[model samples]
Target: MLEARDTVEHEIWWEIKGGTSNVWYENWTKLGALNYVVPTDYPINEELVDVSDLIEGGAWNDQLLHQSFPADIAEHIKSEIYIDQLQGNWDRPWWMLTSTGRYTVNSAWNMLRHRDHEDSDFKQLCIKGVPFKIYFLLWRVLKGRIPTDDVLMKMKIPIASKCYCCSIPQQETIQHLFLTGQFATDVWQVFKNAVGIHMNLTQMKQVRYPCLKNAPFLWNELIDFLEGYKPILVSKIVYWNLPYDGWYKCNSDGASRGNPGPSSYGFCVRNCHGDLVYTECKELGINTSMVAKAMALKKGLMYCFENDLQPLIMETDSLIMKNVVEGIWECPWSIVAEVDIIKKLKARCNVLILHVYREGNSLAYFLTNLAFYFAGTSRFNSFVDLPSAGKRIINMDKQQIPNIRIRNAKNTSGMDIFT
Candidate 1:
C-alpha cells in the first residue's frame, strides 16, 4: 500500500532544474516517466548521464539522442522541448497539488472542507460603509452564535432567560428581544416615523422569525444594510478660498423663489489676492434652478473670455453644476445649449472648473441675494462705492473668516441671464 501511494505521488511530481536529480532515474517529464530511454542494445560510456550531457552547441545534440534512442522516440522527445524545462535550475520540488505548487495544512483543510452553501446574507453584511464591529456582531447573531441569555443558559451558565423589557414571561431570544417585544416595537416605531417609512409590524414579525436558518439572516442583513445606507448624503464641511497666483477666481450661484418662479444667476470674480474684480446679477425669467445654474456658468465663462481673463478658476456651490461641467454627468436637453456655449468658452483659455462649499462661495451667494432686492439686472465692476452689505461680505472673504456651515440650509437665492 505504501509503495502504491509513493508511485501515485511520484507520477504527479517533478524536480526543479538545480536539483541533484539523476537524469537517467528521475522522472523529469510532466507525464512522470522518461520520454526516451537508452536502447537495450546500445553501449554507453558511463553508468549515469546528467542532462548537461544531452546539450551540445547550446542546443539539444541530435547525434547523441539518435545514438541513445530510436528515431521515433527521439523525435517525440525533441518536439516536447519546453522553455522552463530547458532554462530552469534545480531549486525545489514541483508538485501539482496546489496553485503555487507549494502546499500547507490550511490549504489542504480548506480544499477538503469547501462546499457550496448559501452565504449571500453573510456577504451582504460586509457592505462598504458599515462599521466592521457592527457587521461582525450582526453576522454572529444571524449565525445563532451570539451569547444571548437562552444560549448561555443552554451552555450551563446560570442566568434567567425570560424577557425583562415587558411584563410577559416569554423566553428571551433574538426575535423576541428585538422584534416582538413591546419596547422593541416602540423603538422601531420611532425609527419608522423619523424616516417616514410604514409597514405592518405583525406581518413583518410573522415573516421574519420562523426559520432556524434562513429568515433571520435575510431580515438582519436588510436592517443593517438600511442602517448603513442612511448616512451617504450627510453634509460635509469644505473650506473655499482664493485661486493660485496669476489666476482669477469666479464663483457663481443660481437661485429661484419657486421651482419655475422668479430666478436669477449671480457671479463674483476676484483676483488671487481676494480683491473683487466684478459682480453680476441678471434676472432670468421663469425657469428651474438647474437652468439658472447652467446659465450662470455660461455667463461666467463668457465674462472671462471677453475680459481676456487667462488662467481662470471658476467655482460653484452646486454639485450638479460641477459634475455637468467636468463631464462626469449629463445635463438636461434644456440646458445642453448653454453647456455647449460654456464648453466653447472654456476651450479658448486655461480654465479650471471647481466646486466649493457654499460657505467658501458666500460672496457669490450674497450677490445672488442682492438680486432679490432688485427689479432689473445689476452689474458692479468695482468694490469701491459698493453697498455696505456687499463690502462686509467681501471683507469677510478677504479676511478668511470661518463661516459656520449648516447642513441643507439655503442662505441666499437669484439668477443671471447674460447675452
Candidate 2:
C-alpha cells in the first residue's frame, strides 16, 4: 500500500461537493493538484479551511479564486470542476481508470500488465472467435516457449534438430519454423495472397508474417474474406436534415492534408427554416485528424454558447469524437484534455452532438477545405454570402432533397468458417 500510494494518487478524482477536499492537495480539477504547479513561496492564508472556502452561495467565488491562485488555475477550476450544494455532501473519490468511475479488477489488471497495449497490437494478435488452442499457440510462440526442436534440445531431449514440416535438413529452430524456412514462407505467401494484404515484413526478425499478427483477421478467416467478398448493389442515401422547430443545427467538419499535417476545422449553423446563419473556419496548424475533428466540435459548441443557440443539435462526421463525447467509447489519451473541454462545453451549451455522414456535412466540408488556402480564419454570417456550391447544398437541404450516397458494399453472403 505504501509503495502504491504515489502511483494510485493520480487515479483518484475528488468530486467536490461541500468542497471539504484539500485545496492544495486534492485532485478536484484536471489541471492537477495545486501544490505541484504553485510557487512554494506563494502566500497561503491559514484561515482558509478547504475547497468550500472558494465556493459561495452555490457558485464559485471567482473574486476569491483569482486572488488565491494564478489566472489559469482559476479558469481550469471554473471550467472543468463543478460543485453540488447538498448540505452534507462529501467529496467522493472515483477511480479514474474505469469508464464508470468505479474500481474493477479488469481495469486494474490492464493497467498493471507488462505488455505494451499502447501499440494496439494485443487485440490484433488475439483475434476474437479464434480457438483457445490457437490463442495458446500464439502466446507460446510470442514467449518462445513452443516445443520447437531448438527448444526441445534445450530441454535435454536426445534427438537431432531436424525440420518436421519440410524436406530441408535445416535445424528446426523457432525462427525456421515460423519465419525463414521454405514451409513457413509458402504458408505466409498463401495467407498474403488470400487476404490481399501488402505490408513491409522485412524489418521484423523471428516472425515470418508480422502483418498477419498485426491484422484483425486470422489465417483461416482470410479464406472466407477472399472468396466471400463480391461487389453487391448497395446504396445509402445520406442527406442533411433540418432541426425541428425551436432548434438549430450546426454541422462541423475537419480536414488534414496528411494525417498529422496542416489540419483545419469548420462549422456552419442552420435554422429550422433552413437558413444558413453563421459559419466559421480556421486552420489548427500542425495537429492530428482526431484533434482537428474534436476542435471543430468544440468551436461549434463555443459558438452555440456565445449565440444562445439553445435546444441546438450539433453534428459532425467524426464517429469517434461523437462516441467519445457521448461516453459510449473510451477517450483516446492523446486528446483527453481536448475531450474534457468539449464535454464541459457540450453540457454548458446544452448541445446534442451527433454523428452525420460526410455527404450530409458538405457545407462544413467546403469551409474546412477553404481554410487550407487561406492564411487566417474565415467567417460568414449570411446565406447570401455563401459560394454557389455552398448555397446549392443549403437550398437542397431546405427542400429536404437528399444528396445520394452510393457505396459498393461487399457481399458477405458466402458463408465460411467465421472462427
**Each candidate: what lDDT?**
0.69, 0.77
How many clashes does each candidate structure show, in the order listed? 11, 0
Candidate 1 residue-wise lDDT, 1-419, digit = tens: 45444344453344434434545555554434443354566565464366656766556678887776567656744643322234446523544445344645564444445646758988889989999999988887888887778888889999867787987668888887778888888999999878655675334544453221222336566566445642212244445576798889889998888967888889988899989888898777677788788878878887887898878999988888789877888655445546766776777788989877788887778777788788877999898856888898888777787675544322122111110
lDDT for model 1 comes to 0.69
Judge candidate 1 at residue 311 and give its lDDT.
85
* Deviation of model 1 at 88, angstroms: 66
lDDT of 2: 0.77
lDDT of 1 at 232: 17
Error of 1 at 257 (Å): 1.5
Candidate 2: C-alpha RMSD to true structure equals 9.4
Mark the regions of model 2 whose C-alpha exceeds 4 Å error after superposition. Answer: 39-49, 82-88, 109-230, 243-247, 252-267, 279-356, 363-401, 410-419
TM-score winner among the candidates? 2
lDDT by residue (65-90, candidate 2, tens digit) is: 98888887888677645443535678
